[model samples]
Target: MAIEVNGKTIETDEEGYLINLAEWNEDIAKILAAEDELSITDNHWEVIKFLRDYYDEYQIAPAVRVLTKAIGKKLGPEKGNSKYLYELFPYGPAKQACRYAGLPKPTGCV
Candidate 1:
């Protein structure tokens, strides 16, 4: 599949994750967020950027549990909980946020 951003076509997998991680940019993120009818907020960007950094270090997208723990460690307890994450990415924090961040889907997500 493909999405048009800034008059450029970006390819995606069947599940909608970006085909090329190197091609990721803020505009692509906005397009992904729009697919879910969400508007990126500062809170959402925090999680997205956090996930990207986490992936950069680990070379893997985290599942929800790991994501929560890692986020707690990095971003503090207030923003680490599932409640805060779910409020931001109602469709499943790890999956949705990773998608927006242009990381592959988390393991064991099904």
Candidate 2:
């Protein structure tokens, strides 16, 4: 599938995740959150941005433990802890956030 943002086309997998992870951005994230029927908020944006940067640097989705740790280090304990992350993405932060970020399901998520 393909998602269009500002007249530019971006490709996605059968499941709707972006095929070229590099194509992701805040606008893409917004489009994806809309697809999932979610209203983007600061909290949601926080995770999405973090996940994108994490992917860019690590080349892999951070598992829950790594996610929490990285988030804690960067955003402080309030936003970084499991309770907060779970509240934002009950399906698991890496999985659910990746879905909204237009990225594929992380390896080892299941």
Best by TM-score: 1
Q: What tens digits encode model 1's per-residue C-alpha lDDT throughout 45-72?
A: 9999999998999999999999999899
Q: For candidate 2, write residues 31-109 as lDDT tens digits.
A: 8777777778898888888888888788887888888999999999998899999888776888879877766788887
Worst 10 residues of 1 by lDDT: 66-75
Give the runs in model 1 whose Cα sits over 4 Å from its true position: none
The residue pairs that clash in candidate 1, if any, are none
TM-scores, all models, native as reference: 0.97, 0.81
lDDT of 2: 0.83
Instruction: Give candidate 1's whole-model lDDT.
Output: 0.95
Taking all chains together, the TM-score of candidate 2 against the true structure is 0.81
Worst 10 residues of 2 by lDDT: 31-40
Which model scores highest in lDDT?
A: 1
